[model samples]
Target: MKLAVVGGGSTYTPELIDGFARLRDELPLSEIALVDPDERRLGLLAGMATRMLARAGHPARVTTATRAEEGVEGAGAVLLQLRVGGQAARDVDETLPLECGCVGQETTGAGGLAKALRTVPLVLDIAETVRRLAPDAWIVDFTNPVGIVTKALLDAGHRAIGLCNVAIGFQRRFAAALGVAPERVSLGHVGLNHLTWERAVYLDGEDVLPGVLADHAEEIAADLSMPGWLLRRLGSVPSYYLRYFYLHDAVVEEQRTKPSRAAEVAAMESALLEMYGDPSVDTKPELLEKRGGAFYSEAAVALVASLVGDRGDVQVVNARNGGTLPFLDDDAVIEVPARVDARGATPLPVDPVEPLYRGLIAHVSAYESLALDAAIQGGEERVRDALLAHPLIGQAGPADELARRLVDANRSFLPWAVSR
Candidate 1:
């Protein structure tokens, strides 16, 4: 099978490539095409991948390309991992929301909306190319604002699924906290990325949250350390999103404060600046290389395993809800568990989420709609409505003010902004 990874020069690309390489035997993958615009970065990655594969004794054909059409042609699966704008632009995406005294973050609030505006067009273009190049390829998107972008692709009449590691990552963390094997822990989780809830967790068919919380208080507290500590202090396991989760009064009241969107964006910016400024002196890539041995390898192997393993089940994927979520529109993008087999992904039926989950979904939907409208219809009012509908905005007047400021500040990227 031929698998193409779009945006192959990205920082995360190596990890993903390592993932596919580890899965060669299980999935019987025959070729890999790395696609990116920057030839230098692409070559750097391709060389690194070639060396790694040689070391591992795998000999799959590893090719590189600059054009989406060239890389996507005849691909069975296309992993979308492009960053619409590099870290510099993402720094703006994260800091802008905080400047307005609201949550500035990559996947929520004005920052997320801005990201979607920039990313939607690029992703749509790629989707169009895929249609012309590899009509049957399954698009597995690993982009930010996963829900919103996934919705946009479906709206543009493409088959795509948004993939975020947060769900599985959180599940593993919770399993560790509970002193149980990850596979032994069963959970019911639902909501948007970075803001999901653990509705339930069980070990041996018994509710174990209370016991785990009590027994592992110290360990849990230690694990919840970094980026945003305030939310971790409030309660709940510190998922990467401890910042934004804590800011919401509803979630705070439930003692489930995760990070705020602003905090996450800040951390991401700092990390990117560090990456760009001192590409020579950083141990991050090395650390990531070591870490890649597990996550990327295991995940990619799992993908291949699902394809040819003894148990044939479709992998849970992120795709358009299409009545899968009763409360939301049929076209809404959702990340539900999916079963993946040789044929493709089949999403599982999930029950209606909680009111808070629904509320977040609504806000995300409004933001997604505005992004799509701006990208496809060139409308500004829709964008305004999206900002107003956000939970952080609180009131219409404040939302309007925030919208106007965002439009003014990001005029270069958002050319359809209304005149101040």
Candidate 2:
């Protein structure tokens, strides 16, 4: 009946609150505790959430906490959406890897590994507190690098499931293109977090991907930044993040000339916080859509509803492999459709992955394993090894250089690097 949001001060909070308000019948809550370290932001969000709930005639009480232990206590579910170093650090994560001629994005390549090192430890620490304070609560992680973060929680024996909006975003898009209700479109989403593909689009259990692609290949390809012919050739739709790997050189060049995604988000957050301070603003603003995380709240609400109510429904989530993909280690966290319920997420059986996607998934899975090592047991060598293992930075020369830059840029967040 009680739910807690670990990074409730984030500008993303209102979008979540809007979902809670609209979907009350699915997941009824008696209270919501917004947990954050920044009191000013937390206060602003709390007021906004209160107004939204009141306007919706939803009875859930909104509360604020400056500590994880305080907010998560006695809650049925805790959602982790924190940024360990905030946007300033994200700016570094986005731009620092360009020096090595690598894709300088937040959730992949050298930048993703850097974020893992800074984030995993703090998330695990919060999970421990959740263990002590709310032993039965489920921790739903919506953090970047969901695969790595969820794996750390699971490996440490926490009850957690990783959630992302990518699948829902695709489902919604496909449904719109087909002029059908969103629920009627089921995606055969496969691979690891951020690295995934939609192999099939099922309408009423029929594979209609070919038809959808035939009609809107160019439009879909445009959204993913890939060529329309490529979609027809591959017989599947790769997630947008795949562009980083598929068009690495071009992306690197563009990243060199363009402002980082972090900078854009930082500016958006500033405006959103100011908007939240207004008492008259009771609803989520249109500007929030451009802030990204499209359909995030819906995905979160559905997952939480299924878990809390034990619906035993299949939904896409970042869950343990458990032999669903024979090529991957059972403990590897993968983004795929899974049956979610009281026991947590169990990935569904996947059809044979094409060698192209399978090899990359296995490769990234290995890098993620090493990235976790570097995250849990911090050291420059672990960091370098993880970078070397990444498909994007396979060469030792760039890996070594990126690892050094990563640590130097994130020393304040990575305690082990402070001595250097």
Which candidate has the top score in lDDT?
Answer: 2
Cα TM-score per model: 0.80, 0.99
Give per-residue CA lDDT, model 1, range 32-127, as digits (tens): 899999897777667666666665667777899999988999987788878766766666666655545566666777777777777777888899
lDDT of 2 at 407: 86
lDDT of each: 0.64, 0.94
Clashes of 2: 0
lDDT of 2 by residue, 81-199 (tens): 99989998889988988988999888899999989999999999999999999999999999989999999999999999999999999999999999999988899999999999999
lDDT of 2: 0.94
Clashing pairs in 2: none
Candidate 1 lDDT (Cα, 0 to 1): 0.64
Q: Compared to the true structure, candidate 1 yields what TM-score?
A: 0.80
